[model samples]
Target: MTRPSPAPLRVLDLTDDLGAHAARLFVGTGADVVRLERAGTGAARSRAEELHWHAGKRVQRIADEAVLDARIAELAAGADVVLESGPTSRLRTPALREADPSVWADVVHVLVTPFGRTGPRRDWLADDVVLSAAGGMAWLGGDPGAAPEPPPRQQAEQLAGAHAAIGAWLALLARDRTGSGQLVEVSAQEAVAATLETGAIAWIHGRSVPGRTSGIYGHVAHRVFPAADGHVAGGYSGSPRMWDDLLAWMVETGEAEDLAEPQWQDGEHRWSGRPHVDEVVARFAARRSVAEIAEQGRTRALPWAEVAPPSRLVENPQLAHRDFMVEIDAPEGRLHDVGLPFESPALPRPVRLAAPADLPAGAGWAQGRAPVTTRVPRPGTPRHGGALEGVRVLDLTWVLAGPYVTKTFADHGAEIVKVESSQRKDPTRFAPGMRLRPGASYDDSGYFLNFNRGKRSLALNLRTSRGQELLRALVPHVDVVVENFSPGVLARWDLAYDQLRDLNPEVVLVSMAGVGQDGPWRSAVTFADTLAAMSGLTYETGSATRPPQGLTFGLGDMVAANAAVAAALERLHRGEGGHVDLSQLEAMAAALGPAALEAELGQTVRPRSTVMRCAGEDRWLAVGACPADELDAAVRALGAGSLADLAAASDADELAGRLQALGVPAYAVRDGHDLVEVDPQLAARGFYTPLDHPIAGPVLHEGLVEHLEATPGALRTPAPLLGQHTEELLTELLGLDPAELNTLHEEGVLQ
Candidate 1:
């Protein structure tokens, strides 16, 4: 299959390390990017960071900011897109528009900042540690009743960069409709908060305030465990079937003890049976090698993986088979870089090029190709309120990761007809955030409500021929089809991408799974918790002294969801049909930033996280990635004796403020209550939007997270009720009459 190339774009990248990932993404998607900055400061901080971020971009540097605005406007004149970010605002679009409105007015310009342009904390001092805490990620990981630790590397900044890419694409799509350029404003803090998943939802929608559980899920052990050869992530205790299978294995091995008791068989009993069950599981794990345990667990269908560090990612079987790790062409020798987050035919490879060579002045990126054309609506055509107004998508997805993809676009006014089943519903419909309203059923779940908003549900049994025919018929009506079933499940039902292509040649198809459509572990039953461990993140999660803790928040969902949305949108922009084969494994691994690149070069893995106690009970402050100059002054300010004693006397907010005053990066970790109620930055951004649900009543939701100056999206409606739009959707999309709808309903194919 020939990979389809993205529409070629010219981008003037006026960003530092914070916006590096966005520029890299642009390059990967066939954009010609010129990295412009002052001469000395333009050099990357480290070698691996340089290779990972700037491999395929052209570089141009000047002595200083003298004539910088003039140069920026000149570059903007030739560019289709302009990108910038900040420790301080670069304000590229405003400056360009100020200088020459006619030239820069129609350019798609994206500006990414730590806190966004309008928020009160927009100018606050921030780094990885400060952003992590303020964004609500630092509140979830680490040990319970202790200071939460930020993830090892550049988690916050990288996530913001990905969101910046999403915003830029959305703007490009809008540009096609509006006949103008755009200002895409992205907030690193909001991007991190948007992906907190249920951590923030547990408070926003439900009254439940979830706290750090160390590495345990309620009463069960949820972290990595020991093996004779090495540690493995093996402490899952969910699902009745998994528990039964595990108990049987334990009993057969003469290690079951009293777990065979009748009461112990109940899942609720097992949840509370943690300490005892944890000891038994640990004992069993200690007796086996990681190889023995992983192999044996695989045959039994357990969510198990060897907890590999960054150094071992290249040798991972699934990754190696998928070619996710590739060598870079550097002047010195062949260096390594983590490959593209997703694999798709017709899309460009995530190349690792060397330091950019100097190009002639006024050199255009390509010989002579017109800018990608835009739709020009004739005079007096009604404008679209949302950028994706006419777009339609058939959503064959459930759970966290898949739902997130549709949710991102649905917010942009894309009409999504979600194909569900009455027989077997999406499990998240019954998961956490269950509202306390009376007479709640499958449709009453807050998890379902938050993720499925602005979607119409069509209940169809794919197991039946009539249902398959209906789905194939509807394929021609939609612009895209997205699904996350295990690899090949669609083929069995005659609904794979090939089948969809037969129905509509111009339809874009996106198939995402844990390990992707092709790989040794393609069919593995997996979840985000296990994907976390397998991505080499879990091995680097905890403090340096302790064994790495499990990542319960499941960041892989957001990573893959963002990539899938960006890829799908880019494909749609070309007005062509293509298939995006995405793997959550590669997606999550790619989010490790430059950690994998460093480890690939044989550098010793850096230590993970830092924690300091502060005033009040269970209160703490997180600080790290501090500059060398600030470290000593920060230490001296705190004075001699334990850090705990010094910080415990000062309020966390006040202490963080003082540190920030000294140019040291620090932030008091905000909890769920604090975030929704008192986080000034969140309030200033209007990040929390209230939605009135038919079942769950009125609740606050994370509305359109990005700021698009031209065509900002809306939370159009609450998530649909199960099978709520069955008849209406059929009639609208398929032109099915009332009689046909009733007949299908009678046959139990449409419910």
Candidate 2:
């Protein structure tokens, strides 16, 4: 019996490690992934790299570049999309294109490279560490006096892959309307540069350069605290109520000490009293068991979790309850892995794994569209303009993932109305990582200002029935609605998916949370750091001798944000209204790449590649994951005797150039100052846009991570002030009278 493929989309994947994550995600979305490999290539994929990412993809090996090009032309005739990575693609090379004209105007071409396709360093040698430095990520990590660090392993590559997926999906969404395919180019350096958790904002918004700390971003309120059993991540002081409850907990345990004092009681001073607060929290948490602390957190509805490693994945109660863990039998042995990132009735088979396709020799590999599962029919709407100009989004979300998701939409010309409340404001408006202005108003948060750009604020208190009624009225006017409250919060507010569907049958809605919409831990309060710790990302960081380290930024949040963005775009493209239950943890676990497999195969290393010192105080060069032969060559070229002597004598910038000249992957660990003032690649690519905010004054903001040749996205506005567009949006979208608005405000329903 032959079962037809579930998905209709056909992808010719010509990418290596650079685009592996995107291909893996496409497979999960039910696309038919056909991977092309060079016949004589020595290093196509390491065993560890190929473990889980290529489980269900089809493959063919070609002899040389000529044969590969010919095969691509032959297979690409039936393919809808082509995924290419690296700088040597023949598609863009004018010198070689004249020999073979394969100008594909019908198929979407997604190019993922270290730098952009046209940057000054586009053809320069690249590795993960090089991207981290060039992207300004390395500067934000490590201790103040130590060398900067990159996120462990191939995270830089994977981040680019995630962006590539979004770019490809967006292009295809546009194609469904315009019947044209164009270029979607993703720069890994820019992807990392854009997701620095406000790393560059201090320098961009002002002249002050922010320094690195130990894992914690800006304030020490949120971090991995040591537990009696292991480690648990919990520390959030953004909300006054959350701080009061934490203080009450400490006071109950007779451990509040100075925290109960007048000086330390104010939540605003939490940033300044970091040493004392961290000390008190550490003392309170060190003696408690992980289970005990977790129970306490649950009782208080605090965002906290155990710093779980890959080995602990199987033991996760949430995974067990959701049935997320899967077992696959291969030629080697039985292996355990995770499932899809989101669940939707809209997708018949969101995930299906089969043994690698075995086509007989001389048989064609062309399998035409089957079942049409990847995308739904295009919406029945007239096109107004290009670049998402007609889309409307109601963003009932706060903090990282939700706001970032809306930001993606808003930057691309979609109108987004972000909801907030006077009583319950977005916590990010307060202690959102690093801040550009000290003790400024709610508008000064670098994180809020950056992610909330191009969005309009609609302050409404959902607790009131009048407020809920107003929200219900606004639902019919928007194309899509997104929220990231805990599992049942929307249901309590009478705005669940079913209710939203009742309001507007064709409106697309996405409900994203930490665990999922339904699970044993669905009610678990979570933060971005909690997702990172639980997804095995934190366990693989740091040196082998030290305790495990967490990433400097919200890696998990970024992954979930892009996934949600893609889902919303897909749903809107199809013109269908459906519910999407996305687990931020599951999305992050997929980004774990081969780490889980490595842990299973006992090949896991405490990554955090070697950060070697260079000349000048604390200046360093990152030498990450070099092959044995290359490592030997680097040592010989640099005269390796004592690391201490080399640290004092070597110039990182010069040595990085020298090492790259010898085919070794090396680059300087850049700080914010270097990224803004010295990095030529960023300047040449125009990665940063200096925008003047009404309140924040002039600031350089991160632009889009990828490019769309047909219709590129732009930064339209700065972050909105609270209730900035309340009256205008209501009057414009809902036809609400000024008298009604005045009544709502007087009745305390509107903020």
Give Cα distance to truth, residue 558, candidate 1, Å: 0.9
Displacement of residue 648 (Cα, Å) in model 2 is 5.1
Q: In candidate 1, what are the lDDT values of residues 1-751, reduced to their tens digit?
A: 2224444778788876567778877777767778777678755356777777777777767675755666777777878788898754445556557767788777888888878888767766677777888888888877778778666567778888888888888888887777778778888888888887766777766556667876555323466787787777765554667788878888999988888889987766666777788788889888989887777777788877777777778778888888887567877588666777765343345444556556455554553324645663222222357777778889999877888999988888688899998666576675332442234567877677778888899999987889988988888788889999888887887878888888888788888888888877777666676677788777777544887777667677888998899889888776677888899988888877777778766565444335688878877787656645566667677673544566778888888777767776677887777778878888988888888888777878776666888788888788888889899888877789989888998999985
Q: What TM-score, over all chains together, does every model reach?
A: 0.93, 0.90
| Candidate 2 lDDT by residue in tens digits, 389-493 | 667788998878888899998877678888898677676785444455666578767768888898889989898989888898988888789998878888887
State which candidate has the highest TM-score. 1
Model-by-model lDDT, in order? Answer: 0.75, 0.73
